[model samples]
Target chain A: MALLDYFLRSKEKQVTTASKAKERLQIIVAHERNQRNKQPDYLPQLTEDLLAVLRKYIPVTENSLSVNVDKKDGDLNVLELNIELQEENSGK
Target chain B: MALLDYFLRSKEKQVTTASKAKERLQIIVAHERNQRNKQPDYLPQLTEDLLAVLRKYIPVTENSLSVNVDKKDGDLNVLELNIELQEENSGK
Candidate 1:
């Protein structure tokens, strides 16, 4: 009975450790994402490339456009390009 | 010289394996995200909850709103709520 009790306690301890590790990983990932948002080296070059492509279709200035790489769950990177279209630019 | 060459080859093999593992992980994650997008169980309930909260302030129907959980890189889940406000709802 004591051996069984010891095994059960050991299993419970392992589960706790696994969950704690997951929580710690989540915190670290979130912190890293925040830091990346603050200053990503590739953003400007990427934005410039995107803007050049977009200019062929739409008349957009640098001020009217914004771009960022958003980190998602499950190791997905989303490149979000936001363009504010002026009234004149629309309905064409 | 033979031993040093063997060590260098092993190191190169390890690097290749690590990069291959990363590529495989990326493909699996992309597939999982595609599958999740097709049928996510929580989206409707979350949308309903958001609509309920929004209705307290703005007069909106179910047709004018949308909600989805967008998975980002680095284990981030972004809940995007998009509401298409009519002309009457605007400039208030």
Candidate 2:
């Protein structure tokens, strides 16, 4: 019985921290949604064009490419492109 | 001289297409910068906190994690989190 309680206590501690993190993320994510609604409509078009160009040189799927715009300063913004490269002929 | 011209023509074709893509990206990216300026200030903080949470469960580096908020519908927004996982004990 003591062993069961010990394991349960440890499991609860882990859950507590993880759930706290999730709650925090939910709040921040909600705020982010408000800001994102104001973004320009050109983002989707840009993503599609960039993906088409990248596909010409790299073997990438829709899941592997993401484009984002991050605010740097008052007037500066950074266009971030992420592409996950897969090994060619991976023998896995 | 004929062989040289053939190689030059092929190289020029490749360069022209790549350069055209680059120029298009540049123009769209410039427009994106303007829209990104209105994004909320909590993005960096949200990214850091999410990274910290992820580190507790996954072996990820700064370069492997990115968080972005993407607009979905008129009132909905999607918070995208990307983490590039590395193999454990890679026998390379």
Best by lDDT: 2
Compose the digit string of candidate 2's lDDT tens values, residues A1-92. 22223323433454345322111111111011112134343434534554454454344556655545543222222344544433234376
Question: What is the C-alpha lDDT profile of model 1 across B1-92, one tens digit per residue?
Answer: 22223323433454345322211100000101222223333433534553454454334557655444444342223344434433333368
Error of 1 at B66 (Å): 26
Q: After superposition, how far is residue B81 of candidate 2 from its true place, in Å?
A: 28
**Pairs of residues at least 3 apart in sequence or in different chains that clash in candidate 2:** none
The runs of at least 3 residues in candidate 1 whose Cα sits more than 4 Å from the true structure, single-residue gaps closed, are A1-44, A72-76, A89-92, B1-92
Interface RMSD of 1: 18.9
Output the worst ten-in-a-row residue range by lDDT, candidate 2 chain B: B22-31
Per-residue alpha-carbon lDDT of candidate 1 for residues A1-70, written as tens digits (9 for 90 to 100)? 2222332343345434532211100000010122222333343353455345445434465665554454
> What is the Cα root-mean-square deviation between model 2 and the actual structure?
25.3
Residue-wise C-alpha lDDT for candidate 2, range B1-92, written one tens digit per residue: 22223323433454345322111111101011112134443434534554554454444556655544543222223344544433233376
